[model samples]
Target: MVFEEGRIKQWLINYINPGMAFNDIKSVVTHYTALHPTKETYIFNDGTPMELVNLQGTIPVTYKSVVYNIPIIIWLMDTHPQHAPLCYVKPTPTMNIKVSKYVDQNGKIYLPYLHEWAQDKSELLGLVQVMIVTFSEQPPVFAKVKPKEALYHPSINNSFPNSVFMQQPPYPTHSPYPQPSYQGMMPQAAQSGYPPGGYPLYPTPYPAYPPQPSSMINTGTGTIKEEHIKESLLTAIEEKLMRRMKEEFQQNQAELDTLKRTQDELKQGSLKLQVVLERLEKEKSDLDKNITVLKDKEQELDKAIERLSNQESMDVDDAVITTAPLYKQLLNAFAEEAALEDAIYYMGEALRSGVIDLEVFLRQVRTLSRKQFMLRALMQKCRQKAGLTVV
Candidate 1:
């Protein structure tokens, strides 16, 4: 059987997260199905029903040099890779599940690979490989013994028209009394110890009931004469009781194992929850501290804004007073530098208009330039002292 790509895509689309890409999922599904075609079905997970792609097939496992096809089912969740897929042994009716550390009595599989799943690393094929290797060491399932049907004598068999005594040849015997033979059956292959029909003969539950003459049968004297009949009946009853007790013991053992697993899982969940709670508490404490620091910073900002708003607009000279001595000195130097620059420019204009002689203009420009250099140097020193970068 082959899985249709379109159908697989459709199933993913319907169940996967809207923003999650399904390329990995599709690839894994297609690749696995190439070997074992899987069936897609809907199942409830933790009380929430979801449509998922699952494979129900036998995986080839080798045990003691013999290869066995171990039936299994693998479920891929919608949020696969981010989470581990569920796996279980799906035994046939004639097969009984074998419980081990990797596999539970209920047939659920648990593996280190699954527990350590990483979204970037884990995939369906890898999980299946792990299962194959684990099961090879100890097969997850074994065939059950087929029950034998009750045996009866040919005299009793002759009463039923559907009895095999009519068609099948009789088993060889070394009894003192001659054994009855069929008239038209194939010769018994005594050496082979099987009839020509190739069916193995089963030993009777008890020796043949003594041949009943019509007079003894009619008089009921021949009934229950063989003590072996009573012994066989008691033995069959005891065997049945033992079989039933064994089944009940197995069932109870499985339940106990299931409960133990559940307890371990619950303990793990509780530990995780406790860790998360502690982490949340730490985050909350940090947030509270941050809120207090923010409130203090906010108050400082509000006070600074209030102070600035209350001040009236003022000239640069008026605003520069009554501050640190270094700041005051720096502002005074800047003002003088500006005045000297303006004086030099106006002197040049006066000379160009012939309002002043070149000699006077040159002298004035030289003096202003010298004083401006001094002011600039002083400003740089004051800025450095104030821990500000010199511009």
Candidate 2:
């Protein structure tokens, strides 16, 4: 939908003050003007007769011998003065704002002045004074120096209201008391410095409201009164900070304990794995030794069988020339006995040389002697029947 800029500009002229315009038809948010005809943004509403417009400005501030330019924004909702204007501080990109009692990390400034705002009694000048005072207590942290290009604005050089400049933070420590979070949905405000209260294109019919009085207005109030507010706000902030620190300490302690326990479990698991690995290595070595001994015994058995087969073939060839069948049989038996004797002699030699076990060879010797004696008796009987000389 098209907006009636001429009518809206005329309406802003009739309502706000003249000195707030700061010399041109426009004002800057971050060294840039919001006065362009296209910059006027509206929020569509189904119920309201008029739409709310977005207005932003850079409010110059000086604190602790340092000049800082902070941005303040406003949304002029239709249901205005009865509801407080949504006030926020948008620091430069190089600034790091703390989330404290008064200003949130999002740059939201919560002051009691909003609830006390009266349509006729309150002006944008008074609220700006509160913002300046609130921020003075706890200035934002600067990450780096702001760019020079952003600092070059005509509005930035313009002198701020003396009333805003005069207000101080609630403490001697350069900080304000921790105010509670903005309770709920915030309504918007019309700033005298911006279009609604003052715009250069349209002349102002109403003279400036001469600095309206606010509940937080710093009128000096004497030394005792200033000390009391500072002390109370300071005490409350200290208590809140202490509580937060304690909670963080407890959380860190819990995490450290959990990490220590995990480290201990890992150490135990590593020790158990080492023990199991050592045992497996030892068992493997023993099996290797046993396998070597068995292989040596197999080699000895193969040699013994080869020797026995060679002796049998030699005896059979000698017996083939004999004519008596009985004598041939006797001779074959005697050769078998001789082969057994040779086997016993080799086994004894192996045992003495430590190639074979002594007790194991002794057991085999008794078993072989019985077989040798039986073959000797059979050879003698065959020799007697054939009447062959026993050689």
Q: What would the per-residue lDDT of candidate 2 be over residues 40-73, giving only the tens digit for each residue?
A: 3333323222334444545445666555555556
lDDT of 2 at 143: 36
Every candidate's lDDT: 0.59, 0.53
User: Candidate 1: TM-score?
Assistant: 0.37
Once superposed on the true structure, which residue ranges of model 1 sit more than 4 Å away at CA? 15-46, 148-391
Provide the global lDDT of candidate 2 against the true structure: 0.53
In model 1, the number of clashes is 0
Model 1 Cα lDDT, one tens digit per residue, 339-385: 99889889989999999998998888888899899999999999999
Question: For residue 27, what is the lDDT in candidate 2?
Answer: 28
- lDDT winner among the candidates? 1
Supply every candidate's count of residue pairs whose N, Cα or C atoms clash at under 3 angstroms. Answer: 0, 5
